[model samples]
Target: MLALPASADEARRSGYDFMSRATRAMQDEDAANTGMLWVKDGEALWNGKAGGANRACADCHGDAVASMKGVATRYPAFDARMRRPVSLEQRINLCRTEKQKATPLAHEGPDLLALSAYIGMQSRGMPIAIVMDENTKPFLEAGRETFNRRQGQLNLSCAQCHEDNWGRKLAGNPITQAHPTGYPLYRLEWQGVGSLQRRLRNCLVGTRTQAYAYGAPEFVDLELFLMWRANGMTLETPAVRP
Candidate 1:
C-alpha cells in the first residue's frame, strides 16, 4: 500500500494505482478484461440505426476511432444550449434526442454503458482535459461544495476519506483519491459494466446519504468537478476494478 498523504492533491493517482497486481493485470489485458464485452456491444450499437431519423451514431460521427479520440477526456464540457456543463453520457442522450431523434437510453442500462464505454475507449491513453469557463464555473463550485459537505447519519464528507486519508485502508479496501478518469468501468461487486453515476450513488448510499435520481444535475456537477480534479490523468474506459 502507498503511504497516505496529508494533502488531497499531493499524490494524485488513478484508482488503478491502488489495485492489487492481479486486478491491475485484468485491466491491463483486453483479453482478461470482461468489460470488453460492453465495448463490443457498443461498437454494434454505434453502427445500428435507431429512431424516427433512422440514424446511427456513425451517421454523424463517422468512424469513432478518429472522431471520438480525446473527446471523452474533455467532458463534461459546457453546453451552450443547456447553459450548464453536460457529461459525456448526457451529450450522448442529447444527440439521440436532437440528432438521431431516438428516445434516450435508460440510465445505467447496458446500451448506455456500452455506448459510453465504446466512446471512452477511443480516448484511452489520452489525458483528461476538462475546460472551465464562465458558464461552467458555477457548476464547478457547486461540485466542490458537494465534495466537502457533510452528509448522512455518519456526518462524513467525501474529502474525509478521499482527500484527507487516501492510501489508507477502509474495511480492507484501499481508499483512492476520487478521480473520474475511468467510467463505464467494470466493478467486481456489480458483476457488470456500470457508470460513474452508479458508483457515486453507491458511495452516497454507503455514507447513508440520500442518492439523487439518475440524471440529476447534482450528479453532473459532481462529475464535472471530478473530471477537473483528475485532469491530466489517463483515460481508462472499461477499466476493471475490485
Candidate 2:
C-alpha cells in the first residue's frame, strides 16, 4: 500500500459537501455503483489475452487485488523512461503499447475508462500520496501556477470559485473545492462515467477558455498538483456526482 502522510492535514479538507447526502449514500452502495460495471469489464480485460504477444495483464502483474491496491493514490507518478509525470491513464496506455504490444486505447474511451476504474477501485479509501521529489517538483509548481493564474473572459482562477467561494452557488450548481479523489466519476450530467480530465475540460469551457487537448502535458501537471492539493483525502474512484 502507498504510505500515508504523518498527518492527514498535509492536504486535508472538509467532507465532500459538493454531493448531497443521498448522492453520497449512493456512492457507498455497491448495488448502486454504476461504475462497478466498468470495473467488471476491466477485470475481464485484465485476464484476457490480447495483442500480438497474446499476453494478458495477469501474465505479468498477477492478481490485481494484491498488486494494484493503493496504486491509484500514487499516480501521475514520475516515469524515468518517459522522463516526465504520467497520469494513470497515460501509464495504462504505455503498458498497452509497449508491454502488451497492443494498440493504445483512445483517451476517455470506454475500454480505457473501464480499465482505469478497475485499477482505481483497488485503491478505494486510500489517501492520495503523490511523490513530490525534485523531478516532480517543477511540474507541481507549474500546476500551482496554472491553478492560480486568472484566465478566460471571466478572469477567474481555479481558487476563486473553489477555494474562495466554496459552498456558494454558480449557475445553479454548488461550487466544490475541486478535489480529485472521486474521479472517473459517474456524472449525472453526462449520464456516464468520465475521467478528471473531462471534468477539467468542462470547467475550462465554462470559464470560456480554450481547453487543453486530452493527454496534454499541462493536464498531467495539473492532475499532479490537484492530487497534491488533495493529499490525504480518501480515494473515491468511480464515485457518483451530480
Candidate 3:
C-alpha cells in the first residue's frame, strides 16, 4: 500500500512543486513553448483564404490581435443557435461551417487545435471570466454533479483528487488544484500541445471511467465547472507541463 499524506494541507506544502520546478522554465513564454508552432500555423490559416466563400477569418473578424483579445477567457459559453454550451474548439468549428462556409475541422485535429491555440494565445494572462447567470445555471449544475459524483472502476470523483487530496502525491505525482489556465499546453508526456478536453479524457481513463467523446455535452459542462472553479485565474495558453 502507498503512504498517504496526513492532511490536504500537508500534501499541498510538501508534494513536489511541479508548477514551479518540474515544468519547463518560463513555460508560458511564447518564445519558449513548442506549442507556439501550432499558433503560427493558425495565424497563417487565419489570413489565408478558404472554402466556398473564399474568406479568411481575417476577412470577417479583422486582425485577430485587435478583435480576439481576451475572447478565449469567456468561452465554453452558451451558443443560442446550437442551444448548448460550446467549447472554443466547437465555436471555431461552428464559425467555419456556418459563417465561413468551410469544412469543420475534426475534434483534436491539428488544424483545429492550431486555430484554437492561436485564439487562446491572445488571452494569455487574462483572467477567466465565464458568466454564470440563470441561463447558464443548469449547465453549471450538471458540471458540478459530474465533478462530485464518484465513477469508474476506481470509483473516484474529480473532487476526490482535485479537492480532497490536492497537493498530495499519487503514484509519485504531485496533484495540484486542476486549473484550466495552461491549456493548448505542451505536455512532456504528449510531446505536443493538447486541449483541455484531451487532458480531461486522460483523467477519466486514469480512474478507469468511460471517457466521453470529444465535443460531448458532459465534457463542455465539466469544462464550464472548471472555468468557474478557477475563476479569476490568469490564462496561460501554450504553457509547458511535465
Candidate 4:
C-alpha cells in the first residue's frame, strides 16, 4: 500500500479518509473487484472432480491451504525434480496430468487462473524467494537475457519502459516494474482478471515478438526473471492491477 501522504497527517485529517481516496481511485467501476470471483472458481477447480480419466486435482494434492502454503513464493523456481524451471502454473499442470491423469488446462483458462489465484494467495505476506539452484541457474540466466533482448517491430526490450522509465505514462497507463508480486491480479483494463503471464503476453504482442505459446520454455524463463526481480516483496495474488 502506498503510504498516506505525510502532509495529510499534519493537517488533522483522518488517515482512513486518505486511504479511502487512494484506494478508491484505483478501484473505480466493475474492474475493481473481479479477482475474488476468479479465486473462488479456482478453489472449486482444485477440488472439483473432472477430466477424461475421471480424476480431479484434489485426488492427488488434496487441500490447497494446507498443501499449497508457501508454494507461490518459491514459484518460477528451478525444479531439479523435473529438470526444468517451473512456475506455480507448471507445477499445477504437472500434478493434474501425471498424478491426476488429466489433460493440462489452457494457460489463461479459468481453471488455470483459479488455481493460480488460490495458490498465489496462500503465499500472501511471504517474501518472494524463488531459488536459482544449479539446475535452474541456466534457465534464470536465459530468462534475464530474454527480458533484456529486444524483439518485434518496435525492437524494444522490457527494460526500456518498465525498468528505466517506470512511473511514466505509456499512452495513458502508468508503467510499473512489471513486478510479479501480484499474480492472478484483477485488471481494470480487462475489466476481468488474469495471471502475470497473461500480462506479459500482452506486452509481447505490443512490442511485436511472435508471442510464445502458452507454457512455453521462454515464458517460464520470463516468469523466473520477474519473480527474482521482485524478491523480498510480498505476494498480492488476486491483487488489483491497472
Q: Which candidate comes out best when scored by TM-score?
A: 1
RMSD of 3: 5.8
TM-score of 2: 0.94
lDDT value, candidate 3, whole model: 0.82
CA lDDT, every prediction? 0.90, 0.86, 0.82, 0.75
lDDT of 3 by residue, 1-242 (tens): 11224553243321114566535564745577788898899999999888888989999999998899998988889888787789999999888888889899998889888998899889988987887777777998899899999999999999999888887788987787787776877787898888899999999999999999999999999998887766666787877777
Model 1 agreement with the true structure over 88-118: per-residue lDDT tens digits: 8899999999988899999998899999999
| Ranking 1 against 2 by lDDT, winner | 1
Local lDDT at 179 for model 2: 84
In terms of lDDT, the poorest run of 10 residues in model 3 is 8-17
Q: Which ranges in model 2 have alpha carbons more than 4 Å from their true place?
A: 1-15
Which number leads on lDDT? 1
Indicate the residue-level lDDT of 46 in model 4: 75
What total of clashing residue pairs does each candidate reach? 0, 0, 0, 1
Scored by lDDT, model 2 comes in at 0.86
Please report the TM-score between candidate 4 and the true structure.
Answer: 0.83
Q: How high is each candidate's TM-score?
A: 0.95, 0.94, 0.91, 0.83
- Write candidate 2's Cα lDDT for 119-208 as tens digits: 999998898888888898898889889998899988889988887887788887888778898778888789888999999999899899
TM-score: which is higher, 2 or 3?
A: 2
Error of model 4, residue 155, in angstroms? 1.2
